[model samples]
Target: MGSPAERYTYPSPLAGFENAPPLPDEKNEDGKSFKNPPRDILSEAYTTFPEPLENGRRGAFDVHIYYFSSNKAYAKELWERIRREFPELRIYRFWDHPVGPHPVAMFEVNIFTPAQFGAFIPWLAIYRGPLSVLIHPNTVEGGEGVSHMDVERRNHSQRAIWMGERIPLDLDLFYAMGS
Candidate 1:
């Protein structure tokens, strides 16, 4: 029999799949295949809003950090550290239970500018300490009157980045907010 390494050197199920026909490229005018596309093209698109801070607005995005009440001590310590470290940013008090459309207790952190966002995200990534964060932008412009449920769905399902265990949210509460 062959050596152990040689014996187990079998091809993966998708070994030859990479060279197969690629999916249709939506951005291309001719709907051509995206075979061996550039690395940038394969990556997900980043979210951007149009002229968010044009008129002296405070912010364009709000980030929420979710934690269970059972770990109140750790959550409080984390919250205090954030407040102390980033005094310029706005941080809200901790909620013990569900608030707004959120199904679990969470605190809010408001980021007013791209500079603040750039500084805050990386810091949180390293120091979050057993917390799940949900980051969403404030897309409401003019008087569009978009419901909170729409925002929550877009954030939790598609846009928001999760740092830890993603908890289920009560999207229905967003609809009830208008009542």
Candidate 2:
């Protein structure tokens, strides 16, 4: 093996972009000035969500914090602290037993805006001692009188983001709904 420093040298994933071509600035190839400049459009803080999702629901995401029955006390303590800290968030009641698709006891927290998502998720990551957190986007295939339980299933299983141990969900709950 080479020296310790040289042995670990590997090209960065971004190295491919080093020689990438640059896009035209503000003006297009035709040289016609664009009405909305890139800088002007994003001057303010981007702390909002795409509200009223396709299904016309306000919450764009749901954060489920799960803990086993053995850790009920610790989980309850964390839930209380969350209530005190993030009063703005829609924190549902702490269930001591498994509820719906959740295979274990969990408390659901709905996130409305990007700001709440940015703030609360990281806080939970740091403070959720020995807890599993599931973050899933609410993706509804919008239409009139269309049952989208399949979409919901994909959201929970395929598109879900898990922090810490990934608890298996009882997917039968979705199927039982009978779309």
Candidate 3:
């Protein structure tokens, strides 16, 4: 029998994806086969958002800007600046202490369209300073009458995107409320 390292030389478990089947060639209008090109994700991102993210009121995502007690001054200043700069966005009041699932003090911002997300996220990247941001999608996944808390828990834990340091969320609150 070969040694463990030698046995895994070519098709190693870690590199298994390298052996995946090639993407199918696209059929052009003239009935010719050509290599399917990758989509321009950045350019298309400004216009296309998933249909599930279409909430009637509060928009597609929640952006949480978290701060420690030490950096409260800077966080507060940033929050004020966001309010002044993006007057169209739904900006919530700043909380001085941890609220709901969040571990630290944070102010919430809701953005509706993909264009807004493309614009504001980059602007925030430059201006956010030492604060960590949590961006989670909001969706009505189960259609008409299912529990919304289940969806909230999934979005906060599974679908969340973090900028800078990621904080551990207090998911026990979700469990309590969901029950």
Candidate 4:
């Protein structure tokens, strides 16, 4: 069996597809194979939410991540993986059922912190999700706009400035980022 990391590589067609296997050249009708793939998982939860939140004495810092993906399965997969790895992070869903909308799917996912937001990065990239983060380094005393920052697509990694003041925010900003 593949490990959790392996599961992130890529998913394949499961049994019981909408149409039978096709010949190399057969183009039936819908113009795509899984043109409306079935929904797999529609819900999620963190292993450490609600509790730590209620206990209060928040983490040193946190951030908000705003994103939209064109692929539903990919978004869902990323969401699940993010939850499994960083249960302390909270996630809110807004575009699960509208992938086929006019301009394709415009999903909104909010991640509360690196403890939770970082894990979602891999999935979002694989699923083609837009990434706009409100970063707050745990120890950095200032946010006078970073100096050297750029978003990379080749290796699936990049750096962007937080572009804000030194004042920090709590779960609300982060919770809102992912939305």
Candidate 5:
């Protein structure tokens, strides 16, 4: 094993793009670039999503609604309702086992815009029924390529916005990767 102070490194995925043009200079008065930059000539129109974090630090928040595999019937019904009701939102297929950072079988809903979030969360708050929901903002604090799952687990109860029964997550996967 390496020393605690030893650093780990991986090869660059964009090794050939060493001479790529530098990012455009900031246009804002503060000299900082925003995630959703001001509208430009190329793209004059776009949807404005609320920045989950201040200073445009993060993009969006992920809302995962978890249901036991055994409760597939009810979960399916609810999932369909969600689909029909929110056709414009991005919803993923339900997984029987833990996938991504989730510790239980769950279907994911990506809330890109704050308006969507405002509309959806209230409905979920009252209508989720028996399902447990895990909502976390997509922010990277430590470094790039670090999974939010690690940060979630560290502050599992505190960081996440949980709605129901909190299941134990297989956090080993995240720890192993960091090692």
Candidate 6:
């Protein structure tokens, strides 16, 4: 093995692009140029749901719902599946939105009846998979005061997108933009 000195040598610039950052002045006053926008080196971008899923005032007897999915197609498939399997449950998504980079679906579940909401928990426990990382707050409200931000890169797993005659069980079948 090489000495620790050699192994832990400080990071040095790559051969050609040493000390280089994208040039900002490479564009015109029309504000339309550039191969790509400047990357967010010191920043982590953020995005909010298309709409907040909320219910009536707080009370043990109040309706309780969840903004369940950030992914539209998954949400629809799940909802349709649930509706068929469990026809008695009352679930609805007032606002349907798809957030890029997030494959999870989200929709507020309107629990207009507390008793019904209680019943929904059992089914949720069983069906909740990786998607269950989603949460149902006691009160659905603005994220400003919320302490947590759960952001995940899109899952390019087998189930990522549903298209074509055969459901792709591998990534090689998926389209990579401009394909």
Strongest candidate by TM-score: 3
Residues 1-179, candidate 2, lDDT per residue (tens digit)? 24534423333766535876564567656679754434536522355444223222447788899988788888899989989998987889988788879988899988877777788888988999999999988864645544577567667876689999999998787877844
**What TM-score do all the candidates reach, one by one?**
0.62, 0.69, 0.73, 0.26, 0.60, 0.29
Model 3: lDDT to the true structure:
0.83
Quote model 1's TM-score.
Answer: 0.62
Worst 10 residues of 3 by lDDT: 7-16
User: Model 4 misses residue 81 by how many Å?
Assistant: 0.6
State the number of backbone clashes in model 4. Answer: 4
lDDT of 6: 0.37
**Per-residue lDDT for 17-43 in model 1, tens only?**
578667654555556644444553432
Off by over 4 Å in 6: 1-74, 85-90, 93-105, 133-179
Candidate 3 runs further than 4 Å off: 1-45, 143-146
Candidate 4 residue 77 Cα shift, in angstroms, is 2.3
Stretches of candidate 1 off by over 4 Å are 1-58, 142-157, 177-179
Best candidate, lDDT-wise? 3
User: Worst lDDT window (10 residues) for model 1?
Assistant: 43-52
Q: Look at candidate 3 and tell me the lDDT of residue 23.
A: 75
After superposition on all C-alphas, the RMSD of every candidate to the true structure, in Å, is 14.5, 12.4, 10.4, 18.5, 11.1, 21.4
lDDT of 4 by residue, 1-179 (tens): 24535423323444345575543654448766534433565323333333112223334233333334444454566667666765665454545332311122323334444335446555444543443444332222213432112101101111123322222223233224324
Cα lDDT over the full model 4: 0.37
What's the C-alpha lDDT at position 19 in model 5?
87
Q: Number of clashing pairs, model 1?
A: 0
